[model samples]
Structures are given as structure tokens and as C-alpha cells.
Target: MTLSDASSERTRVYVLQSRQPLTTDPAHAFPADRYDVVVVTDGTAQEVLREDVQAGPVTVVRAARDEWDSVVTSMPPDAVEIVTNDEYCVAACARLRDVVGLPRRHPTNVDGYLDKVVMKCHLAAAGVPVPQAVALDPVVVAARDTAERAVSTLGLPVVAKPRREANSRGVEMLEDAGAVQAWLARHDGEPGWELEAFVSGDLGHVNAIVRDGRVEPVQAGRYLGPLLGVGEGRALGGWTVPAGSEWAARAHALNRAVVDVLGTDGDFVVHTEFVARPDGRLVVLETAARAPGAGVSELALVHAGVQLEIANLRLQAGLPVPVPEPSGRQACWLWLPVPPGRRWDAARDGARAAELGVDVRVRQVGREGNDGASAAVGASVVLVNDAPGGLARTVDAVLNEPWFRAHAV
Candidate 1:
């Protein structure tokens, strides 16, 4: 095999660690013998130099969290690929990749993927369906009259959110004109507030791998309940829509459209959320270039046969991406939010959640002594079960059981 051959030649890979670790092991796709792996972490040395990084002949570099660009710029020119599963790190990774002349999404276009305001604008311009939206200028949003004028076009029950945050952070649905005014008053000084019409429909999502304009179905799921109506500190859980169905195809197509509009130079992982109207129309909510967080990647591996971490790395390495077919197995996942000021026995609770079914897989739970924990604060459970309906029922039962809420007070 010549050095020009992609499959035969060894590749040097650089992986940047997000606040959370990779969903699947890096070695799954790139065997140690075929790849030289270097892991860079923003975390403390003690935190990142753990079992996984030590398990292989891998080098760990500890850098200040904000110095990712500098770290990448200084890498040996021979380093062939750079990738990160972190959504927030996409821009810096793109910048570094561009600097090294690596094939990936252009750094100039990442804002359209990360920022909701810019994202909707691009989608709309591309003739993709998106909820009506307006970015509230800071000065106008602070004034009652101007704020009302800014939001008038979006109509009542508008959704307000920060332009750049994810996992629905700073996302809220305002019911009426008064609610809109109150939301503006609460977020008075904060800039980058975007208001959109609250589309009424079932919230659905599609995760897939797109290479050269082809999309492979990862998993299509629908939210079991109203996401924003639950208010703060609420965990959103849902079941995967049965694969190989009409609805699933629409979701996949919508995801593909998002990728086409965003325009990536090579294969990329897409996590797109959309709303499915009762009239059978699918409207895109937003899309991200990185793998979906909160164990959705695990769900895809279990039910859809796609290893996202591997696919992402493979694409970055310029290797041919193998699309995985859906297994037709029903699956469900949940991000259980742990309330603040309470200690949790992660092991015991995880076991109880597991006992819900034989196919249950509980990825993680918050351990004791961790207070003020919420989903955003890194306290949550990532559970997937074979029984689609059973997963939600079991989770609800466990959450409601008085004994289940044992506080380490």
C-alpha cells in the first residue's frame, strides 16, 4: 500500500476533549496500530489523564480551555485530522482545520450552524421551512414599545432564546403580549435574544451521517411531552419513531436539506431537530454539525447500528464513511434532570432504573455530594431501553416514587 492510499496508510489524529467524553471509544474506528492518537483536554490533568487516555499509547496535552486554537496551530504539520464532539468547539476546530488546510466545514460558515438567529436566516434563504423569527436588537428589546413592535410580526406564544446556546438553554415560550414583555424585562441587558413564532406540533429529531449528499438514517424520535411547558429543571424524554416509515423518511430528508444548505466540504454528522405538524409537514427547528449530546449517540449505536464518534472521526480522516442501516428495534432515551441542593446515590438509582427492563442501559447518574445539579449543571441520566413505551413509564414511575427521591441530606 502506498502513502497515497487512504485505507492502507497510517493517519495521525488529534481529538479535543469536550466537557464530556466521547460517546464511543476512539479506537473503535481507528485502531491503535493504524492511527497515532493525541488527546487534548481543557480539563485538569488529573481529570483527563484517566483510564481511557491511559488505556492506549496516547499522548495527553493539558491546555487552558480558551487556548484551543493556539494548541492546534502549534501541532506538527504532519497531523492529518482534527475533530471534536463538542458543539461549542466546532468553530475553533474549523479554524484550526482551515489553518492546516484540512478538508472540513469552512470556519466562516459555522456561525450559521451554532447561532439560531443566523441559522434560521440561512435556512429561510435556502427555501427551507423554519419558524418565523426576528433577532431583537438590544436597545429595542429593552423598551416596551419597541419590544412589542419587534415581536409583533412573530405573533403570540413566541419562543425566545439566546442565539448561540444549545440544549434549549435560555429557550422559553411566551404565551401572550404580556408574557413577551415580561421575558424582555427579565432578560433586559442580555444581548442576542431571538424571538420566533411558537410552532404547534410534535417535536421530532433526526440524526444521520451525510457524505457527498447521501443521508443515512440514524434515529428519528419524538418528544413525549411539551418540552418548554415543563418549565425549568425538567428532563425531556422521548421514544424513537419506528424506522423505515414515511415520517422517518421526511425527517431524514429535512436533515439532509439542512446539511446541503450549510455546505460542508466533506462528510459530516448532523443532529437536526424539527417539528412535525399534524398536517404532515416537517419544519426544521435547528441543526448542529457535531454529534447529539445526552446519550443520543449511544441510542444510535444500539438501535441504528451507527457509531457516531467513529463516523465523525472517519470523515475527518478522509476515509470512506460506511453508512449503518437501522435495526428496526424500538428505543428511547431520557435526560433526567436532578434538582439542586440534593445528594444522589447514582449507583443505587442507576440500578433501580436498570431493573425497569432487561434491555435497559443506564449510562450515568449524578453521584452523592454533588449539589445544585441540573442537566445544564452536568447532573443527569442517559437511559435507553428496548421497550419504547416501557422506557417512559418506568422513568416516570421512578421519578414519582417517594422512596426513589432519597436525599443525602
Candidate 2:
């Protein structure tokens, strides 16, 4: 084919990345022969690499987050596809599509996906069960009656969180009115805050792929505890719910309902988290229009044949995604945070993991003395097993025996 023919045939994809892409091999994800990929980054994340740019079919462009609009506008007005797994870039990608005169490919309810308050409202409107919430803007937050009204409406022990942040950032549980007032005092001028009635239950998530507006359920998993408890002397871990199990079925049903109400008119991956209340009620917590963080994607790869990040990228590039099938195996991912004043002991941890089995994969190791909030994760663990209950047993051993070892700096 001539250059003109090849260029015309190849799909032009603009991947807005905030962090490292999930796939280790970018070439494989966006093949040179099929895609003309331009990776736009804010330089805040270490996503695009020298080798990726040097290789064929990929071009890297650096633009500060604030300048993304201008950068995209200055580009050639040729038709292009927008793709991003970054939660912060979801709306930006959607808006940029209009700027480039490309048809929208994201969920029509983009605001619902980005803002927690909006999301709950949308779900509740569709008769989907969600936590009772009160949106607090700057004006409402400043009023003296705001805290009292919120506490009265949602009752005590309310969960206050930023309306748009992910990874449980700025989430706090206020057990009393005084605590709520104090929390509000700290954010007197900020916007995008919401207070919701605390739901005490087991936290779980369902991941699915949406193709041509069809919601394809992938894997449902339950977290060991709330993600907010990550830095509070709690390890973050989760295991895939066994396929065909009651828990998986309930999760899948809820996931479908969520996607349906959230306007599933496009191809993408949806990560929806819900709470399984002790009363046997499943209430939707939140949903994101992107791949989940941590090793959840890795777990999906083992549980089924789909890795969510790659699937999301493919969906955006107009490429075909794999139809996920349960592999009749189970997988789990664990994140161990290094205690304050301690550093990770990779040798001891590796040895202990080996003793457990060869299925264990140590995905990440933190730097020495990196005990800050952002760098608190000392190690990441992902493992898979075929034997019945083998995955849970291994996870128990890892937690009880504590495979993640650390040394004082």
C-alpha cells in the first residue's frame, strides 16, 4: 500500500495518559501496522517512554495539564480517536473529541462518572439503590447550619469525601457532629465535597467491558476492607469472586444496572464499587469510566483472558476486544504498606513468597525509607490458583504469615 493508503487505513488514536500505561509492551497494544498513535501527556506522569516514541507508529507530545486544550486544538483537524484510562482526563477526553470534531465515544453521562454526588443522583433517579448523600458546595459548606443539617439528614457517622477524587483520597468518617464541623472547617473554601450516610458492609467491585453499548461482565471481587483504611495500619487486598457464585451473580446484576443507568452508549471499561450490607442489600457506592488501579487489572487477566487497561485502550482505538471467559481459576491482589521509619526487605519477602508457591508475583517494590502517604506501598502481590479455595488459602497465608517483610531504616 502507498503511504496515503496506509495512513487512510490506519486509525488515528490520541491516548491521554496521566500515569504509566498498564501494558508493558506498548507496541503490542497499539500495533504500528494498525494504529497511528499520538500519546499526549502532561509530563506529570512517567507514561510515554523514549523507546515507545523511537519505535514505529507512536508519537509523543508533552503538554502541561492546563494546556491540553490548546495543544489539541493546534493539532491537524484530521479525524482522531481519544483514549485515556486516567480518571482526571475522562471529561477532558470527551470534550477534546468535540474540539477535534470527532464523534463522542464515551458514556453520555460523563459528569456522572467523574463526580460522586452526580453519580449517586443519577443512579437514585433510575431507582438504583445508592447511599443517601448531600452535595456541599463552597457556599453550603461555609454556612454554620451546613454540618448540623448534613448530620441530621444523613445521620451520624457520615462519610465525607471529595466529589471527584479517586483512590480514596480525602475520604473521612465523621462519627459525630463536632467531627463533621471540624472536617468542614478544614475545607471552608473548596468545592466538590459531599457527605453521605456511612454504610457498614463488605466492600466489593465489579469490572466489565462495554462494546457497542453492551455490558460484558468480566470479574467481580471483594476487598478485604475499605480502601480508606489503606494507610491506617491496614493492608489492601482483594480476591476474585468465584464464577457462578451467588456473590458474583449479584455483583454482575448490579453492575449491569449501573451501566444502564449511567448511559452506556460507548465502548469502554467500567469499574463499579458497591457495598454488600449485612442486611443482604447491595448498594452502589461509585463507578469510574476507566480501568481500576492496583493489581486488579492483573487479576482480571488471570481470572479471564481480558486485561482491563489494554481492553480500554483497544476500545478507544476502535479495535476489537476479547470476549472474557472465566478460566476456572481464581486470582488475588495484595498491597502491603511499609510501616513508618521502615524500608522494604525484598530478599526476605521474596524468599517467603517462594516458600508459599511459584504462582505468587511480586509486582512492585518501594524504595527504601519511602514511608510517606503516596509512597507507603512497600510491595504489591498478585497470584493465581486453579485448585478450589487455593487462592483464598494463599491470601490467608500471606496475611497471617505476613510475607511482606520490612526493616527499620
Candidate 3:
């Protein structure tokens, strides 16, 4: 599984991206002078020209919607692989892989991960425990009686969400038929709305590296509160539970089951979440075939000594998977709230954050003119502590502070 055994000294890789600037870090995934990498971005070349490109002998192709065929036609015919780390970019990556004859998840089948209705159906067919769900198409969502019918069919207190969105966008709980109708009325004609029976349980997520059709090195964590239930401006965070613990074992098993059912191939990261019921049963919430985003990888590195991006690259490059040692330190990552016009100084806030037991800090505060109601607007704070409740208590105390109010703009 060494680099020499994986592939030849000269290889080609193409990366698909939506808008984020592409970097050259993937060069390290291979041997020195081994890879000729090309990054295909949905943005224009002028857009990413100012970015810091970290890797060389690397080419960046800014692809417009209609120019994808032309871009692929221009690539070196022997491209070994194509990859992407985004949920929205999966299909593009898959298409590129297929065009280049590289191994990847089937392009047509990616809807099993992007579309909630498709995902739940696959889970249900595989005998996986999923919340009862019904899909509402554009026609159904636009009708006046849609929500009433949905409540009649799916029952009350159901969660309604867009089938194709990420980051919990347009996800809300409807307590009654009226609320359902109101929600549908506001979202009329939008496609892919799914009404799912609410499952009350402990919310948790398992992020794992799956390779050779198996799941391993799984990490489990708990959300500070209901992730999708939070209002527009609310902040939420998660921390890693030490590996090989009781819950971690169970989560690993569940993650394996999910990958097995999905028939995922080769090496990829899976973000699977579940709800552990009070009666001791677990229900599959949803799963995505991508690395956990929003500093979860940083939490993993701090607590488990694994850099997910590097591992993912190595795996995709046909190299050995680096086994990470568990650091046995508790870690928590928080998306703190900030006002639209307010300026946040992480250096000053680091001292305040330290008082709450965040000894290790990685803070990124949003800039001005950003949407304050968006969780992406705040600082992403990573804290490390030895005590079991240290990170949790710190997060709670920080959330209780006046400046952390979710209702503020």
C-alpha cells in the first residue's frame, strides 16, 4: 500500500469544485513529481486566479455549464482519477470520472445521496431503519391542499426539508396541519419537499473512512442541540467521543451497515447520522458520501490525529490509508453567532474562550456584509480539554452570553 506500489511516477488527477478556490495540496498525496493534477472549477478562471494555489504542474480549468464537454475533451486521456469534496459537486465529479474512465460512484446513482426521497427509499429497501417519509413533488407542493394531505399521510410533528439541499437549508418541523400548509404555501412550486415522521431521540453523527467496501476508523460525536431545528441565526456545535468507546463501536457498526447497503466502492468518506431512541433502537437519519464539513475534520485531527483531507487524497491516489492514533483529548467545534456589522477578534475572544476550557483554539470569524442569520457568518471555534464535560460546559456558557444571541442580526 505504499506510494510506489499504488501507481506509476506519472499520474493525472482532476478535481471538481463548485466555487471554493482550489489548492495544490493533493500533490503530497503522491510521490514527489508523481502527479499532473488539473482542477476543474464551476467558476471562471478570473474568479480563482487570485487564490493561493498550493500545488504545481497543476492546471486549473474554469468550466461553465455548457463547456464541460469541451473541458473534458481537453484533458490528458490517461487521467487516473477525479474527485470532489462537496455534496453539490458529486455529480460533476462522477461525470468527469466516467468520462475519464476513472473509478467513482456512478453518476446516475448519486441521487441516492443527494435526494432525500431517493436515499430513504434505498434505505427502506435495504431494511435499514428510517423515519417514515413521503415525497412531495412540485405539483403536490404547489397545491393548496398539499400540506394538509401530507399531514394526513405522514402524521403531525413531521420534519419537512428540501430533498436536494445541504447544511440544513429549508428544513423545519411542522407541529400541525396549519403549519404544514403555511410552510408549503411559502415554498410553493419548489420541488423535492419531503415530509418525514419525527423521531424523538438522541441526535448523533458518525464520520468514517470507508475503503475496500468496508467502514473503519469511525468517529462519533453529539450535536449541542437539534441541528436542523435551530432558527436562522442559532449556533450549534459538536465534539468527538473518544474512539473505541461503547457508543463509538455501535456507531461504527451502523456506519458499516450504511456503506454495505449503499454498495460504495474503493475509498471515500461517509458522514452518517442517526437518532438513538430511548428504547434502545437506532434509526438512520441520513448519510452523505463526503467528508464532514465545517471544521469537523479539524476536530478529528485534534482528537484523533487524523487529517481527513490528506487521508482522502491518499486513498483516492491508491496509496496507503494512514492510521491515526487517538489522542484521548476531548474536542468541541462551535459555530458562534455574530452580528452583521460587528467585528470579532479571535485573539481577544481566545482568552474569553479559554476561561470556558478551550485550551486549543482554531477560530475563523466571518467578515462584514455577510448574512448574520447564517451560521456561516460566525467564528468556527475548536476547543480541546481533558475533562469529560469541559468542552460541553464551555459551549453552554458561551451560548448563554449576551453577544451570542441567535435572534440578533
Candidate 4:
């Protein structure tokens, strides 16, 4: 059908964006011929929209995060779809669906995905293996007692995490009762904290597309190290598990169980992380109702033909999701956080990456320090190879290089 012929019958889709999409051309995700698309983003995102998209049929509207409710309520009620891939905006999008009189397209227990304490409770109730967690209210005078109680219950070396934050923003590891006490005292009177027993196992994640409660597993991979290690100057990276591998099957099954327990009544992309214990048991660490960060979605695009973020957008817009086919190439991605007061020297990093003699795609190069945000990406690298262990070995070689430090200004 011609673009003009389909315009009159197009479904109105409103995409809520908090950051620039990983897709080079987001407009292509929602074809102008089939969907009338409007992107609702903040003022900061205006400049990032590509020029062609700005001149196309898709419309752009500026609405700050805090002002989303007002902006959503004022939107024309005829809008058929509301979509967002941002972690911070998931709950808001769920609530806004009601204001527009649209049928609930998100999980009924949406809070379970937003709050760690609530999420663990739901998963535990469903007989899913999750870490034993104790919720903590901010305490002032009784901080020591509170810390001692948590340690006594959950054991020593607990992980203290903000219940609602994402990207490991306020996560801390307390090795002893005294450390927990000190950590608690520092954040006195702050709310929404929880303590869970630290699970020592291989960290891995699975990304999938869910439609009508059926999960189509996309890709599963093992992390080089814990995400928390990134703050200690460790380079975070992971390699995709080859199709039909034992780890892939186990990860996919665990991901399926998580979706079933989490109430998968709607269509969306689910990002799940789990710890594979040495004894062959998989314990879900946490799950999100949106696309994952750290170039994972892009890695999926490389390993499989499906880009999860784009699939997420298409699902929300009532468009058909593309089936993923293995590309016969294993993919690995790395993120190097620029240290404080240092800038990313893309030229030098590119030069170093070329020495590895593999396909190294530099996805992003941050020119300024990332300010210690665990979620920030100072530089990103993607490597794909057809050999069985080529990607993993190249990832190791990339990590061993002093690229970030050697190019220090």
C-alpha cells in the first residue's frame, strides 16, 4: 500500500522516550504508512532526533519526566498505543494507560517490576527461587540495631539496594555487621532500602519477546563479572551463548518461568538476570519489563536478527514482530567507563581496537567522564566472529588492553 493510501487508516501510536533509542532510525520501526507515530520526550531529547525523522510524517512532542502525567492526560483519547523502553518511565506509562481509557497492556503487578522488594515477594510467592530479602525503612537512632537484625537474618555480606532504583545506582555490598551499620548510618532517614543475601554464582541474563504469555527467547549470555565490579575500574563485557547450547536452554527455561510467575498477560519485552549456581540451580536475580541496557539490545541484533528495542516498539504499536534467525556469528560487547576527570579518546581507542584483528564496532565514545554512574557508558565495543570461541577470546584481548588509561589526557 502506498504511504498516502494508508495514512487515513493508520493507528495512532504514542512512544514515550526518556533517552535516544539505540535504533539508528526509530521512525522506521513504526512505518508512516501503517502507523501515525508521535514521540513524547523531554526537551533534552529534541536535538538528538535525526533530521530525516523530524521532517517525516512522525510528530515530536516535548514533555519532561515529571510532567508526563499532565501531558499524557491532555493527549487525544483516540491514541491507540502508548510505548516506552525506558526503565524509569515504565510505571508512568502503565498509569497513563488508564487516563487514556486504553485497555491495560502492561502487567497487572507493574510495581513488582519497579521495586526490588516487591518483585522478590511476588517471585518468591510463585515458588520461583529468589534471594531472601528484608525491607528496611530508613532509621536514625536504631541504625545499628537495624543493620544487626538484617545481618542476623540474611547472613553477613548482604547486598543493600535501593528498592526502586535501576542500573545498580545505589547498590552496596556490606561485608559485616559493622559495614552494614556504617552504610545504614550514612543514609540515615532515607527511605526505600532493602537487604538481601549475596548470591555467589555466575551472573547471566536472558532477553525475550513475549506475546500473549508465550516467550520467544532472543539471546542469553554470561557476564564477564558482576555489574558492581564496574565501579572498581573493571571493564564490563559479555558474550552471547551459542544457539542450542546447554546454557542457552537452561537460561531460556529460567526466563520462561520468570515470565509465567510475573503475570505475562500483555505483550512486551522481558529482560531477566539470574545467577547460575555451581550446583546447576538457576536463581532469578531480577527482571525488568523493558529492554535492557549496556548494549545488550544491540548485541541481540548482531547475534539474532531481532533488535529487542525495536521489537518492543512494534509490539506496543500492534505490529507484527520479526522472527529471530541465528546469524551464525557469536557476538560480544564491552563497556569501558571513563574515569573521573578523563575524556574518551575515540581516536586512540579505535586504533587499539583495530590491532585486535577482529570486527570491532565502536558503538559509542563519551567525551566526558561518566561521573561514576554504573549505568553510564563511556565507550562501547561490539565484536562478532564465526569461530566457536573467537568472540570470547577477542573480548579478553580487548579487556587486557590499557586503552582507556593509555589515552588519558
Estimate TM-scores for all models: 0.80, 0.88, 0.82, 0.85
| lDDT (Cα, tens digit) per residue for candidate 1, span 345-407 | 656665665576422232223344335434322233444555656666666675575434435
Model 3 segments beyond 4 Å from truth? 1-12, 19-37, 43-60, 105-109, 229-232, 345-347, 350-376, 387-389, 393-409
For candidate 4, write residues 269-318 as lDDT tens digits. 89999999889888988899887876687788988888888788667655
Off by over 4 Å in 2: 1-12, 19-25, 32-37, 43-60, 73-80, 138-140, 358-367, 371-375
lDDT of each: 0.67, 0.78, 0.67, 0.74
- Global local distance difference test of model 1: 0.67
- Candidate 3 vs. truth: CA RMSD? 4.3
Model 1 residue 337 lDDT score: 46
Model 3 C-alpha lDDT per residue in residues 114-214, reported as the tens digit of each score:
77888889888998888998787654465657666777778889798778877777788889877887887887776677889999988888887877666
- Predicted structure 3, TM vs. truth: 0.82
- Can you list the residue pairs that collide in candidate 1? none
Q: What is the alpha-carbon lDDT for the whole of candidate 4?
A: 0.74
Q: Which run of 10 residues does model 4 get worst, by summed lDDT?
A: 46-55
List candidate 4 stretches off by more than 4 Å: 1-12, 18-25, 32-38, 41-43, 46-70, 73-75, 137-142, 341-345, 355-376, 402-405
Show pairs that collide, candidate 3: 24-55
